[model samples]
Target: MTVRVDQFPEVQGVVSEPPVQARNLSVGEVLGQVTELVQAKKYDEVQALLQNAMGQHPNNGDLINANGYVLTAMKRQSDALRWYRDALEFSPMGSGIWNNLGTAFKHLKFYNVAIACHQRAIALSNNEAFLHHNLGLCYAEVGQHGEAIMAFDRALALQSDFHLARWDRARSYLHLGNYRKGWADYEVRLVSGQIPARSVSGRQWTGTPYAGSRLLVLAEQGFGDTLWALRYLPRVKGLGGELIVECQPALCSLVASLGVADRVVAKGEPLPEADYYCSFCSLPGLFTPDLSLLPAQPYLSKPAEREAKFEPYLRKGAGCLKVGIVWSGSVTFERNAERAISLERLLQSVDFPGVQLYSLQKGSPEQELQGVELRRPIIDLAPELKDFADTAAVVANLDLVIMTDSAVAHLAGGLGVPVWILLGHSAHWLWLLDRADSPWYPSARLFRPRIEGDWDHVLDNLAIELMKLATVKVPLSSVG
Candidate 1:
């Protein structure tokens, strides 16, 4: 997935304010104070100060632009756009105002407008590295990987130490399946301050032999990321070291059951003594740089006892297919809006004969199902699911899973369960591009939208596939 560039706070440099005159300060001096407030994260105070200053100097371009910047920081992109336009009216030739406007447009997902604004900024000041970087992000969002890469290349040419540009370029490279450059450039995650470096005692592992040593694998990023990277733990163990995995509390029980880590510790808990450590996602770059040596087998399984607890929910009519469905992920995720579809939309589009659809969706998005009519009954099992393990146990009882991009998809894939993932045109980087099969999950199949944001096309395609799957007679032994 393309990371949103506007999500990062603009880095500010220390600027000495010019000496105040006998009367009121100039627009530049007032804007300097606004910049300081922004840097301090006093967004409300910045807005208030900007409003009062803009009242005093209504025609000042700098004050208008500063007001727009504050609105953008407050996540009022539409309001920010209006202020930015006002600033342009006062000083149409200012490159900085155009660049800031482009950032606001980018946040609002107006890629074409953002591109135009950034291009205008470049036209005004062609040598500015940030203009190219911002332009690159707009291209990436629109799935123009080649142009995004070129824009980032130009950015780095102007400023070699631009780590954010490097990190974003890495995503575009990975999205295009250039794994070698992608993973190598992915190290910029740390340098760019996207993923903080852990402050453990031991030196970071560099794929060197760690025979008879203890290695601590630190889990980074989201739950799905950790789950996806867990498949590499056995390979870490094969490097001849005892492994201790540090992960989020929700995943402790699940990761412990994988049998690759010698011990699993939840984050914020006391760590066991280890000789070396590495982030979980970093293992792929070290062990599978070519992306060719993937262990496409089930690395996770629901315990027999846990599976037994959920067995009662698997009951269906004779010869009926049991399917689990997750239409949303965590609402707080950056791309959750793009990744999740409404349950009503999904239900309206697909029809599965002789199939029982179980609701595997969780979080606020589950409310979409409330008062919605369905052609077939859907059992809501989300309340019963205590954790990822509980979800896995329930999934173990189902014949197949249909989901949007979520942790459940990764869970089902990791368990070797038959899963069909519905994807947008710009899917996650791991799923790659233009392929139905995944190297990470041999049993997983992908169904992507024909056009961006056209879920109707994707759902229509899925309905056809579901009909084909429904015709297959699954052996009773496969169902819990």
Candidate 2:
């Protein structure tokens, strides 16, 4: 990733004179040009340049490392590993090469090994900001938020304007439940250009009372995030403004049920001019929410009418503890694989007696059920679900909802349903660090992997908990 390819260790055994076609460009100069091409995402052109450079400087560490970085950018981490190792052989003491190797390992989910590799890189070249930033990322991935924050501090210390480090450090702070600093640091994302640049037509709201004015609250980020932040609309409504909430069409009905917003508009719908506007994610920062002071739950009501409309579907099963499960969240989320678990693994723990299971899972993962055998039959509810409203309606009939960190968790939690959130050891900031229950959702219990990246413990503990529920807890009167 670094453009300084040959300054470190002198890139020994390379000819000082350039090849004729390169127009007298030295090896370092050619590789420096290669970096620009890589950044432009001209992968094929980058390959051609690297190939020619490798031919001229056969043992150049920078050329080998650049090959690795390009392969990584091309979504070929496995291939990148081979090139990184080759680079390390020639430039064993090259810190940047070591950093690239660590990055490849990080992509492959070998966090501990990647951590060590990054540390080695730092030991060799302590002044590089990115090396510390990469190390911090691995630490955060493993749920060591404090250590990650320290690493991020070192990165920022080395390079004060390192936007990515600031953004990542904010995540670490939020995960540790330090809203004071986290919320402030989180604003760095806007400055880092991680999101599309916005052009606001009016003044930005900063949680001020708009007494006689209309204030727009636009939903941003993932659906799950919007769902989680919906709890704050009531507070904003309390500010005496005519509130408007704009969201994706799929959530229009569910969001409207809150009735806090004077108007709930779907994206692309005709919009009303507002005096001021604020982002949904930005609300938490403005309030600096105290975890212990979470507002009352059931912020969203389960539409009793939809429950009646779907009554015939569950009529045949009258006397069982109805449970719903969602195995995956939005696939586009960068950390989807970390929060999501295999449906098969969850089934191992959820097949307890007196419980009727329903598959609330949606999207491509539904294909996982095609060849799966069931010792106990489960109804697939996802086929009937048309939107968040339908999901909430079905949720009304269930005594319990067990799911990974998906929007369903937020939906059920907001509805005051008894929900269990299955989390990766490295869960999101909302779950906080070392908690069995959530301050945001009083009825929700969190189950985390005892060891990082291993779901065996989570399943084992969940099975025992389910056994207790099956034998000891009374089935909810509504469900049974």
Candidate 3:
């Protein structure tokens, strides 16, 4: 579609329409065609259409803003910022342009600039619920949960049906240790498209008596989350019903060994008949609303053969503390950049005298150990580590396990091993806030950075604690 540039005025506010076209078509019709192409994943066609539109209507804010949208969709966020700036020049007071610019800045991790842009959008149009939601996201990125929650509340107050805002508020609440409201609000995950609702025709298990029936517990979220939620499975079994746990492939063997379920099935496989179904995470809300009510103990055990296989690797020097260490988790995890520490940094910061450090790190992060000068010895056991079952055997043989927040921490805690977990300033919701201990893992101790991103201080504190452990004497038989 072609537009006549001289026929359109420089519209202010939101730029509701593009410049008039010579082809006898409204700019909205051309934009609608572009939107259809974008939705169909024809990005090349959308880009050509947007470029053509912008060339014809050089001063049109709508065309420029649409170009920004297309660029952002293409993951060219830096280029998107340029187009957004050009759109703002044509319609300086447009709240939509300001909001779009803020979102683009957020993608580039310029959170402070994103916050300023969102606030400016709010100043121009105070009732825009999405602007408040965007502002809340910026606050949450900076670890300002209070401001984030307030912004989310404002967004919710303006638009009660804003499930995404409610979902984010729930995360903020959980991060601050307000589990009572957080779990209830967490149900909005289904509505917000964070979790797809299963097509189970049976009733959801709600902690009610179900004598002699079968319950199917569906797994959701990460590996650590599944391990943490397994603590409630035995309770479900005790309610006078057989349990069938649907879990990820990596966790099927581990979960089956726990003896909490009558049958363990991997997710996406055909399921056996059951009377009811429930999400693994929803169990905590039903059974342990109060943190004190959680049954935190050694609920998992390693197979005898697996334990026997690693027995030779458990040998330690006289009077030395054997400690297993994990410096990283899944690289694809969103918060891994903040949670993971480099092997070089970990080696330089802590000195464990009379201690044997065993590496439990796996995947791509394990590659960090190559060509690094080690201040102390760390036995590389990662190459032989096949799965969680193998990792559990290694933990069972250790006197202590020190690691960052990962599934290994969950494995150690579930096996009742003594573990010290290093956490970032704004750690996961499971760790909660400002605590050295966890209600979910009675045997686990936590060390958190006093300041954000200050791993040196956290490692220094851990080193001091390790010194105390080194002075003590414990029998190898009682290590597990």
Candidate 4:
């Protein structure tokens, strides 16, 4: 656990036992070819090449470092650590090795150690922008957004065109409620090519008058993002002659009902000719970075037939405070572990007097409730819910929705249903920082954990809030 390189001063004494030999290629020449193979993603080839070189020059710092670099790229962080330790012995002053060593610790989630290593690397080589970027990411992991921003600023100052740094810097800003600055840097995602920017190969809409031409508004990112951004379509409707919306098939039915677009089409369907294309998530930056351009909630209505289809199940909890809950989001999301709460923990919030809890969770997470005993009976609606449309119909009947941050939060909030969002210490930037309410969804009340992944405390606080509501009946019109 002693990460400070100074603790291992003996590393400077001796290295690689009794291997005095030479190779045709010098260590620098071997590193050049190793760099090429690494750039080509031939990690195994780089390892093989390094192994051969290390046999001839066993104590060489560059060879040891190259082995560690390729292993880190291969995601063998633990294995990489050994090579990094060996590299540090021969070249303790190597800033590149220090940076690589920091990354290995980072992959292992030894963040404080990684931060110290990055700082050491920066001390030796201050001009490396990516070293500062790595340091900022470690800071962001622990909810130090202000420090993260400063590190990102230093990275950007060193390399202004570093889109990766800018994109993360923007997220830090967005998390801090600096929407204007956040939105400006957020546009770098288009050129960063990190996350896919869903757009057509036509003119990009830039908030100009769209009176004469067709504008295709494409949905991007997760279902929660689309659900949140759909509220902005009405504002876009007024700016165009024909506003065509292309979204995932699960959302087409719901998006069509909003009537904001001239045409609603599922993604990957037949092409709709348009003069311009824009991303639904990008609407804010084009119109206004701040929250002023948002249209009213409940822009989408429950389809009457869908509502009727779900009424029999919804009516089961007639005299109780019907509450819907979604404990998790898509598993494929990189940050799902942070945003998602366990169903066992989430149920604690709904266990108040006279409150009926219903599970609105879909996907494999519904399996968690299969054999579980509960203090209060929770109606399982997962099998009955088909898509966003089906879920919206069920949410329309709920007195409230209490769940972790997920698509259901947005679904309920967009429908103007009262929703209490359980947030992580630092995950979704849309919720902003240190606030109990969201400007994007007036109906949403946010809650964050006192400590990382401490859902029990957050839910306990939420239970107190829900207990107050249990004493008073939720008005019918307040939801649907």
Best-fitting candidate, scored by TM-score: 1
What are the clash counts of all predictions, listed in order? 0, 0, 0, 0
What is the per-residue lDDT of model 4 for residues 23-55, given as tens digits with 9 covering 90 to 100? 566666676666457556777776776788888
- Tens digits of per-residue lDDT, candidate 1, 1-480, equal 001233443311113344333336556666666655765688887677667777789998877877777777677889988988998998899887888888888887788998999989889874778789889988988889899999999999999998988998999998888888899889888767788756786888998989989999987889999989888887778889688999999898888777778889999898877789888888888877676777758888885657775666676424678888888888998788898888877876444667788888888877776776665667788888878888888887788999899888889999999999999866888988789988889989999887678888889888887887675566899999
Q: Which portions of model 3 miss their true places by more than 4 Å?
A: 1-49, 74-79, 108-113, 316-318, 351-353, 373-377, 450-452, 463-480
Report lDDT (CA) for all predictions: 0.80, 0.81, 0.79, 0.78
After superposition of all CA atoms, the RMSD between model 2 and the true structure is 5.3
lDDT of 2 by residue, 1-480 (tens): 343323221111122323235544566776666655655678898688788778888998778887877787776989988998999888999887777778788888898998998899889984778778889999998888899999999989998988888999999999988988998888887777776665555688988888999898886777788888898889999989688999888898988887788999897777778889888888888875557666777788876667876676565446767889888888888789888888888888998777778888999988887877875678887878898999899887788999999989989998889999999977888898889998888889999887767788887888888887774455598574
* Per-residue lDDT of candidate 3, residues 274-367 (tens digit): 7888898888888766777877488888766678767666764346788888889899997798899988788754445677778889889988
RMSD of each: 5.3, 5.3, 6.6, 7.2
Task: Assess every candidate by TM-score.
Answer: 0.89, 0.88, 0.83, 0.84
User: Which scores greater on TM-score, model 1 or model 2?
Assistant: 1
TM-score of predicted model 3? Answer: 0.83
